[model samples]
Target: MTEAAAPRTPGSPCWVSLLVHGMGTTQDFYADLFGWEFVPGPDQLGPYVRALIGGKEVAGIGQLPPDRHLQVAWTTYLASDDVDLTAEAVRSCGGTVAVGPLDAGESGEAGRMAIAADPGGAVFGIWEAAAHLGTALAGAPGTPVWNELVTRETSTVCKFYQTVFGYEAEAEVSADFDYQTLRLDGRPVASLHGVGHALPRDRGPHWMTYFEVADTDEAARRVVELGGQVLHPPRDGASGRVATVADPEGAAFAIVRSTTAG
Candidate 1:
């Protein structure tokens, strides 16, 4: 995996959602680990879950319907002004348009979004924000604030993202980290880096979600207490203590608590 970068910018990285894993999990798994209150409601599609971070609606956790064979993992979303345009861009760039441009008005957010898996195989979200500016509790304990992608070919992922997202892809490799940050109008948007060999098919190329916590050790303990497994345990990542974990239902995700995150 590529080493992570210091924030290097004035604000926390702009991330929208961490959509990971598939049929093997229930929203309840994340609800307990991170101490969230779930609000499930029926949509035209069926029942969906929403939650509050800082008392403002920010993120969601949902299950694939019985017929959809989605893998268990999480992805981070970036806000877009127009998701339909983004979906069209994905098709033109050789990536698969996996989900919407479908309305998520039920998720306490207005507008449309579509999840796409890039040609390099990494999945990232493109969102059109409406009533929701994105996440409520950003860069804080128990919420997702920032993210990056680890791909086998940085150049391929970079090209695909730029072509699809209208980004100004950068070649400025970090001296401190083995990654490149995508920019839009000179603002950092997403990041890409080289990875080793192929990721397990079960663990496809996907964006990772970061949940802020006050204490990594405490969070790790809570994970086990709440019926989650520590896949990587607590280790020192560049920014802070990090761990790879799977909830009781088998959804894989990572956690970190950084003195520097917010």
Candidate 2:
């Protein structure tokens, strides 16, 4: 694969998603983080959990079958009224279409999506909103307001997204990091990019969730107390401090308190 900067349609991101390992983890982790309340849906698709930050529904977590291999992780799901059309666009755009406009079951009707790499190895999900409009949470401390991509090839991924979601990448991202923003319907929705060499080998391609926190140090410590592991300590960044972590089952995610609103 040729290497180049994967530029995305410059703007802000739209929405993100939360993936989980098991049901209890899908419940317990965010409950401590966002003070979420449980809402029962059809007992079959399982319970739908809503996280409340400042007394408003900010994010959500739900259980999935073990085979999905998607433990508990946050994925920024961009809005889409037509997932099938988007999937087709993904194929025409030179990106690998991993999933579909297939049935995601009563999660309020979502067009399922998964894509890879930039200049072509980071994997993230695209949720074409149906009944669910996305996380109720905004830029509240301890809730998710932003989702960033850490990948290898940044440019190829940009083309894939532009073709898949009608997004564009920015030209500048500070020498410290590279970034590509996903835009849809002429509005910013999510982001794409390459950062660390952690992709391709350790975890394959995946979307990581970043939860808003007041203090990264304290939050990382709490993760340890709650059966989660602190994979990396809190580090300084333009977005304040962030710590890489995993749930009880070892599903990875991050916690951040940004300087600007996410």
Best model per TM-score: 1
**What TM-score goes with each of the models?**
0.80, 0.75
Regions of candidate 1 where Cα sits further than 4 Å from its true position? 1-28, 41-44, 106-109, 168-178
Candidate 1, residue 21: Cα displacement in angstroms equals 9.9
Candidates in order have lDDT scores of 0.64, 0.59
Off by over 4 Å in 2: 1-21, 42-48, 66-72, 96-100, 103-123, 173-177, 181-189
Residue-wise C-alpha lDDT for candidate 2, range 128-191, written one tens digit per residue: 5444444555666766656666667566666666665556556456786667766555555556
Q: Please, what are the lDDT tens digits per residue for candidate 1 over residues 73-104?
A: 66576666677877787888888877777876
Local error of candidate 2 at 261, Å? 6.3
